[model samples]
Target: MIEHIIEIAFYLSTALTLFILMLPSQYGPTPRGSSDSAAEPKTTVQVLVLGDIGRSPRMQYHALSIARGGGQVDIIGYHESDVHPDISSHPRIQVVALPPHPFCLQTSNRVIFLLLGPVKVLFQVFSLWWILAYRTKPVKWLLVQNPPSIPTLAIASLVCFFRQTKLVIDWHNFGYTILALKLGDNHPLVKISRWYEKAFCKSATAHLCVTNVMASVLKKDFKLESPILPLHDRPANHFQPIQDDQERKEFLLSLSETAPVRGLLKEGKAEVIVSSTSWSPDEDFSLLIDALCRYSEISNTSKPRLPHILAIITGKGPQREMYVERISSLQNNGKLRNVTIRTAWLSTVNYARLLASASLGVSLHTSSSGVDLPMKVVDMFGSGLPVVGWSRFKAWPELVTDGVNGRGFGSSGELVEELIDLFGNPAKLEKLRIGARESSSYRWDDEWTPVAGKLLGLV
Candidate 1:
C-alpha cells in the first residue's frame, strides 16, 4: 500500500512539474493575491488545511498573526462555513478554496472511510499539488495542520523539498492516534498509519505543537531533529467577558428565538452554561448526557438543589442527530427537569458573543492522544467563563488547573457533584469566573508573536 501511494504521488508530481515547466506563468495557473501589486508584504506564507477553513480556527489565527507581522498569507482549504470577517476581509490574507472532497464528506463510518480514503486523498493530492506548484504566488514558507496528515504531510513535504519553501507542521494531535480510536491501536492499519506519520513528519523544517507533552512525544518518539516549539492555543481578541450588565442582556436578547435562550432570558435566571462540540468521536457527549441525567435526579430530591439551568451546546457534527434524539426521549419521559439542553451552530461572531455571555462552559473532549488540549476550553477561558471537563487525560491538568479557572471530573456523578458545589455557592462560581477573566487577559496576539511569529521570521 505504501509503495503504491508513493508511486502515485511520484507520477502525479512528475506530471505537474512537466506541465508547469512547459507552460508560461500567464498560460499556466493564473496569478492571485497580487491585487494590491504596488506595496505587498515582502514575505508570503501558505497555510494549508485539508478540512473546512471555518472549523479550523487555529490556522485562521495563524494567518491573522502572519498578516499582522506584515506577511501575505494564502489560506488553502474547503469553503464549507462562514469564516470570521477578520480573515475574509483582511487586506493581506487571501483564501484559496479547494474543490470539495470526492467522498467521505457526510459519513463518519470507519469502513466507508477505509474504502474511500485513498480515492479522496488522490483528489486532494492533485488539487493541492496544482495549487502549491503554480496557482498562487510563490511563498517563502508553508504551514500545515496534522491529524488529517495522510496525504497533506507528504504533499507539503514534497513541495517544500523541491521548491525550497520552508515547511512548518503544526501538530494539534496525532493522526494515527485518531485512527486508533476507530480501529484498535494494535490494528495493522493503525501501525501503518503511525509509520506514515513518523516518516513524513521528518520532512518538516520546523514543528509547532499544542502542548509540551506533545513536543516531548514528537522528539522522543518521532526522533525529530528539527526545532519543536509548543505554542499553546489562546483565545482571539473577539472572545472576552461581557462586563457590562446591559451588554450581557443585549447579547442574550440578540440570540435567535430558541427554548434555551428564552429560558435564560427569564426575569430572574439562575445561571447559563454553554458547551460546544464538533460531535466528533473525540468527545464523549454521553458523559455529559449522563451527568445531566444525574443532575436531574438530584434536582428532584437532593438537598441544596440547583437552580433552573439553561445548557446550550453549539457546533455541528455527525453524531448530533443521535444525541438530539436521546435528549428528546429524556424530555418526553419526564426525566429532564430544571435543565434545558439545546444545540445550534452559530456564526463566528455569534459564537464569540455567546461564549462571552455564558456563566460557565463545559468540555467533554477525551483526547485520543491524551496529550493534546481542547481549544474550546481555551476559548471558554478567554471568554472569562469557568469550565468543567473530563479529567482522565494528561493534558487536562495543564489547562483546567483544578480550583483555579476550572474543575475536572472523572465521572457523571463527580460532574454533578462539581455542578452542585459550584452552582449552589455563588461565591465559588464568582471566584472561578474571576480566575477565568484573569486567564482571558493573556490574549492570542501577545502569545503568538513570541513563538510562531519568531519561527516564521515575522516577529
Candidate 2:
C-alpha cells in the first residue's frame, strides 16, 4: 500500500511538473512604465541571472540584489505559484521566465534520470538547443547553477562563442564529480554531465564558487583556474553582537510564539526545531531523524524527561514521502513518542522565523550530495541558532567548529552521538548556542558584497 501510494505521488509530481513547464510563460514584471523612447540604451554592464532561483528565498534575494545593484540585469527562471515577489522593482531589473523543462531541475535521485532514459537525454539536448537558438543573443554575462542546468551552461558557453560574453557559472554544487561518483563513468548521462562540467569550466571566463572547498575541488580535480567568489547569502540588516541577556530573552520569546513554534512551548516540555529546504535520499537526514527518535523515546521515560523534539521540514522534493514515511514509521513503532515530524511549504518569512526559534539547528548531506553549501545553514546562522550538522561534503567543517559555534560529526554514528551530547548537557548547549549566534555573520554575502561591488564596478 505504501509502495503504491509512493508511486502515485511520484508520477503525479512528475506529471504536474511537466504540465507546469509546458504552460506558456506570460512575461513577468519589468521596470514599471519605463517606455522604450524614455529608456536609455542599456550600458555594457548587462547581466543575465539564470537558473532555479525560485527554490529558496536567498536565491531570489541574491538575484534581485544583483539586478537592483545598478547593473542591467535580466533574470530568467521558474516562478511557479502566486507567491512571486516584486523582484524587478529596481530600474535595472528585468525578469524573464524560462519556460519549463525537466533539465532545468536539480534532481534528488540520479537513478530516476535513468527512468526517463533516452527521452531525458533528447529533452535536455532539445532544451539546450532551444535556449541557445532563442535567448542566446541578448545575454552578455551568464550566471547559472550546476547539475541539471549544466547543459544550460554548455549552451550559454556556445552563446559566449557568438557574442564576446563572460560566462559566470556559479558552483553551488559540484555536479560532475558528484554525478560521476553516483552514476559511475559507464552511464551515458554521467559522461555527458562530466563533459558539460569540463566544457563549462574551460569555457567560462569567470567561475563563482560558493565555498573554499568547491573552489579547491574545481582547481584540483578539473584543473580549471576558476577564481571563485564565495556566493554567501546573508540578511541585509546586520544586528550588533547579541550581548545583553534581556535582549536575548526578549528575542527568544518573540520567536517562540510563531505558528509552527507554538507546539514546542508546552508547560514543561522542552523543544528544539530542525528544519530544511531539501530532504531526500541524497541527504543524510535519516541519521538525524533516527537519532531524534531514539533520543525522544529514551528521554520521555527519564527522571527529568527530555522535552519533545520536533523536526519541521519544508520543501517539495521527490523523496519527501519517503522521509515522511520514515519518520511516521518511527512514530508508529513508539521510538518517536516525544517527536513530531511535519513537512509543508513555507514562505520565506515563516521559514526564517522558524529557524530563529530553534534552540539548536540541524543540517545534513550525504557524501554523494550535490549541494556544496546548504543555503539553510546561512539562514541558521543568520537566525542566530547553533547548528549541529553532519560533515558529509567538504564545506561543513569549515563552516562549523567541533566544540565552538556548532558540532560536526564525521558519520551517521558520530552524528547520533553528537545529538545525544547536545541534548544531554543544557549548559554546554547554551555555550554552543552563544557561539552559534556569534558565528551568524560569517556568511558569503557579508564578505562578498564589496567584491560584488567591484565586479559591478560600483567602486
Candidate 3:
C-alpha cells in the first residue's frame, strides 16, 4: 500500500511540475524546454546523489569529468562533509544540498528501525519530489547512485519520464543485498527491496556498474534494455605517488604532530601502514585487530625481528568509537605490540599524501553484494601502494592480482602470515610495490574519457 502511494506521488509530482512549467514566465520558474541565454553554453547535467556528497567520491568524479568536458553540472545531494575543492570550486559544477531526510537514521535496534522505516520513506518521497519539482532546473541527462535504489530510483525515473530526460544509474552494489544484511535474507522486506530494485532499474536509460560481474548480473537477471557500462573507480589526478623521499619525510613529520598519532611515530624505523574504513557493518575490524595481535606475537617472541608498524586507519562512521576502545584495550593490556594503531579523519589533500607516503595499505571491505569492488584499494593503487585486501568476494581478484599488484586474505591467520612475510622480507614487499606502481598510470580520465565521457557527450 505504501509503495502504491509512492507510485501515485510520482505521477502526481509530474502533473504538478507540468502545471508549474505551463505558468507564465513571471509567475513560475523557467520551463524545461527553454534555457537562459546567459548561462553555460553546454546543457546542464544533473547528478543526484541521495547519500553524502562528500563521501560519494565516484559520483563526484563523474560530475568532475562532466565539468572537464565543458559541461555544466547540478550536483544534488546532502553536503554532510567537506567536498573536494575540485568539484565544489569548479565554475561548471554546482553542488545543491537536498532537503534532509527527517528521521533518526542511526538507530540500529530492529524494532525501532522497522517502526521508523515507513515515516522515513514517506519523508524521503516528499522531500525528493519537492526538490525535483521546484528547486532544481530541468536537466537533459540525470545520473543517480544506486543501492539507494528505493525512493531515489523510483523518483528519478518518474522525473525523467515527465521531463524528457535520460536516466543514468551508477551501480555500486545491490540495495536488496545490503538490506538483507540487516533484515535476514529470508525477510519479506529484503524480498520487496529486490523487487523494487529490478522494477525501477528497467527505467534507466544507461547503467554504469562498478564491476563487469555486476553488469552481467544486471543484464542476465534484471534484463535491462539500457547500455550497461562497467565503470570501475579510478583515482583522480590528485592521488599521486610520492616520488621525492624528502616529501614523504616532511609528510611524516607533519603527521607526527597530530594528536591521534602523536608519540606513535617512529619515522624511518617504523613501517607505516594505512587503512581506510567507513566502520560499517560489512567491515569486520575484529579481523584486522586479530591479525595485528598475531603479528605482535611474531614480532616480539619470534626470530628475524620485524620493524615496528604504525597503522593509520582513516574515515568516520557509527562503529568508529567502538573499534577505538578495542584498540585502546589491546594497547594498554600489552597484548598488541610493535604495532601502534591510530584513527584519523583526513582531508582529501592529506589523505592522498598519506596514501602516497605510506609503505602499504589494508582493506576491510566485504561487499554486501559480494561483487562490488572497494574504491579505497583503487586509491591505494593510484598512489603506488600495494594493498592487503579482504578476498572474501568475487571482484577482489579483478582489482588485486593476488601476486601482482597486491595480495588478498580470507582469514586473520592468513593476513598475519601475509603481513609477517611481506614486512619481514623487504625484497618481496618492494616487488609488489613495483607492480602496484604500474597501476598509477590508470588515471580516471584515461578510461572515463574514452567511454563514459563520450557516452555523456564529451568530445
Candidate 4:
C-alpha cells in the first residue's frame, strides 16, 4: 500500500509539472499596485470581464456599469453575431473575441462534447490565463458569468490568486442543474460537475446573483459565505416607449415582408402582443401559442370588435424550427386568423424597437434555475410593456404583482382567460400599460452603480 501511494504521488507531481510547463511564460515581475497590498485608492479601476456564453446581455450590462462607474473594462467572450453596440462602442471598454469552437461543440452534441469538451475547455482556460496574467493590464477585479455549464470559476479563481485580484462570479444559473437537464441527474459527469460547482463557488471572493432567491440558494445549498448582491436586470435609458404614432407606423412597416404584421398594418389599428423566448423546452412556449390560438378563436367567434392581433415572438434557439413549424401548421389550418404569429431573430436595436411598440408582452420562461428571474420579463418591464408571466419562479413576486404592473398565470387556461379579458377591455389594457411604465422608472444605472461600486470598493 505504501508503494502504491508513492507511485500515485509521483504521477500527480509529474502531471503538475507538465501543466506548469504548458502555461505561457509570465511577463516579468508583477507590476507595482498589482499585489494585494496595492488595493489602495486608484484613479481608474481596471476590470477583466469573462463570459463563455457570448449572447448573454448580463455580462454586457455589468461591463457597462463598471465602465460608467469609472472603470476601464476588458471583456473576453466568445464571438457572437449580435454583439450589443453600447458594449462595443464604449471608450473605456475593450472587447476580445475567442476563436469559434467547432460546429459539433457549438451545437451542444452530447457525444462530440463529451469527446472533445475537455480539450476545448483546456484551450479556453489557457487562452484566458495568458490574457489575464500576461497580456492585459493589472486588473483589480475579475467578473465572470457562470452557467457556460463548465467549471470556469476554478480557472478564474486560480487566475485571481496569481494576479492578486478579487474574483466575482455573477451566478446566472448553476452548471450542475443545466447539466442535469441535458444529461440525467444520476450521470457520473453531472455528479462531478455539481461537486466542482460547489467547490469553486465557495472559493470566489464575491458573488452577484440575478435574484435574491439565488443568493439564498447559494447560502443554503452551497454553504457559500461570500458577500452576494442580488443585481436584477433593469431597463437601460434607451428602452422608453415610442410615443409617436408615425414612428410606430414606420417601424411596423420596416419589419420583414414575411412578418405577420402586414395583416395588422392593413387594419390601420391593431393590438400588438410581443413575447420573447429562448426556444428552449423549459420555456413552455406552447402555453403562449395555445393562448394565442384560443384568443383568436374567441375574437372571431365571440367578440367581432377586437382589434387584429400581431403576435411577434423574438429569439432563436435549437427548438426554434419545431415551434415555428407548429405555429405554421395552426395558421395553415385557419385556426389562427384573428391572430398572426411571427418569429423573428432580431438585433438588439430592432428588438427594443419592437418592444417599445408593443401593447402587451408575454414571458414563457420558467427559470431553469427556479431562483433566477427571467430577464426577458425585466426587459419587457423596461420597455413599459405590461407582461403576462409564469407564476412559478421564486422571484416572480418581486417583479410581477398580479393586477398591478403585470399579471402572472399558473396555467395555459388562466393565461388565455387573462388575455381575453385584457384585450377585450381597452381601459384595463391601458391601465396595465401605465402601471408597467410607472414600475420601470427605476434604471439599471441606478440599481447597479452603487452595487458595483461597493463590490469594487470604489464607493
Evaluate all candidate structures by whole-model CA lDDT and list the values in order.
0.84, 0.61, 0.84, 0.76
Question: Would you give me the overall lDDT of model 1?
Answer: 0.84
lDDT string for model 2 (165-184, tens) is: 56677666756556665677
Candidate 1 TM-score, C-alpha based: 0.91
* Candidate 1 Cα errors over 4 Å, as ranges: 1-38, 103-105, 257-265
Give the per-residue lDDT of model 1 (tens digit) for 1-459. 999999999999999888557432442222244667766575778999988999999999999999889888999999999887999899989999988865444457788877877777788888888887767665688999997988889988877766667889999999999988888999998999899999999989899999999999999999999999999999999888888867876777667634454644666455678999999888989988888888878877867657767778998887999999999999888777877788888888788888888778999898999999999999999888899988798877778778989999888888889988888888999899989999998888787899999988886
Cα deviation at 416, candidate 2, in Å, is 3.5
Candidate 4 has an lDDT of 0.76
List, in order, the clash count of every candidate structure.
0, 3, 0, 0
Pairs of residues at least 3 apart in sequence or in different chains that clash in candidate 3: none
- What number of backbone clashes does candidate 3 have, counting pairs of residues 3 or more apart or in separate chains? 0
Better of 1 and 4 by lDDT: 1
Over 218-265, each residue of candidate 3 has an lDDT whose tens digit, in order, gives 999899988999988898898988878778757876884243443544
**Candidate 4's error at 336, in angstroms?**
1.6
Clashing pairs in 4: none
